[model samples]
Target: MIQSFRNEKYDHKVEILTPISGQDHTYALLATYEGLAEMELQNKKMFEDEEYKELITEFFLQNIVQGSMTTQLFRTMTGLKKETNSQK
Candidate 1:
């Protein structure tokens, strides 16, 4: 599925989300690539981190939990406290 949202503040900018698909979920290759691109933009550092990449790969191999993946990526990138667990 393609998820898109608009922000009035960004005016011309539109946010499109394409999360990865798990074994149970069927997703288009283009959509998954788009999601990866979005994640890269959101968290460049996390993508660059080898350890983080491995963890993410493992998580995806197990299941593509879009919400969890996105949330973790965002939190890791923003250095914000996680919803369930706080990180220093």
Candidate 2:
């Protein structure tokens, strides 16, 4: 984990997060990747292609729990904490 501070109304300093320290993250990645693969293979032109699905999986695997509202969909999936003003 890493701790950093932001110049908020107060010192927003804290231990940020402890990453997945074992194979669970890997399994979760594989599971989600497979789901994307299934969608790409079966679903039509409304969405994903092989390359696009690969890109999505890559992003998901790289940051399962990012601290940003723009990544809302991912936060919901990974159960990431709610974003605060300081986090933004």
Candidate 3:
């Protein structure tokens, strides 16, 4: 669940497919760090001060959504095939 611009700019909610393995703390932390780095790279124009940028990264790093893409894709593909065969 993401709330942007005080719930006014983007109030829409999206359904996400989440996998099980990334729920572990190690992967979650690594993913969050990677995401923060990417954000810093992209939002370099918006934030000029290093300290403020570090604060933003700290907040995001504290909260990260963890998931495994491989597991979710495998489940979706296998489920689709199973359903198709059952229909036939």
Candidate 4:
């Protein structure tokens, strides 16, 4: 599934993370975009792709637990200044 998403050639970053302490059986798939607009554009393209559709129907639907999936979006806080070591 991770490879499939990478093959789509979208202009974003993707990563899969496994828990170190909590949630032993759970994994997180993270996709980062420049902003909301780029996220929307890439999502539209992803859903429209035939390969992605096939993956969802043939693989994701069968293996993943029903009602166990969730989607969340987060954005970095704006106007935050990076504190240099010297400033501390």
Top of the candidates by TM-score = 4
TM-score per candidate, chains pooled: 0.28, 0.23, 0.23, 0.77
Model 1: per-residue Cα lDDT at residue 76: 26
Candidate 2 segments whose C-alpha is farther than 4 A from its true place = 1-47, 66-88
In candidate 3, what residue range of length 10 has the lowest lDDT sum?
A: 68-77
Q: Which candidate leads in lDDT? A: 4
Q: Over the full model, what C-alpha lDDT does candidate 1 score relative to the true structure?
A: 0.43
Instruction: Write the number of the candidate with greater TM-score, choosing between 3 and 4.
Output: 4
Q: Would you list the clashing residue pairs of candidate 3? A: none
What would the per-residue lDDT of candidate 4 be over residues 1-88, giving only the tens digit for each residue?
Answer: 6554754578888887899998887888888899999999988987898977787678676768888889999998989899999998
Instruction: Give the CA lDDT, 0 to 100, for residue 77 in model 1.
Output: 45
lDDT per model, in order?
0.43, 0.38, 0.38, 0.81
TM accuracy, model 2: 0.23
How many residue pairs collide in each prediction? 0, 0, 0, 0
Question: Where in model 4 is the C-alpha error above 4 Å?
Answer: 1-4, 82-88
Cα error, candidate 1, residue 64 (Å):
2.3
lDDT (Cα, tens digit) per residue for candidate 1, span 1-88: 1122122311223344355655544342211223556645645654666765776578577767556433222222446555755533
Please tell me which model should have the higher lDDT, number 2 or number 3.
Answer: 3
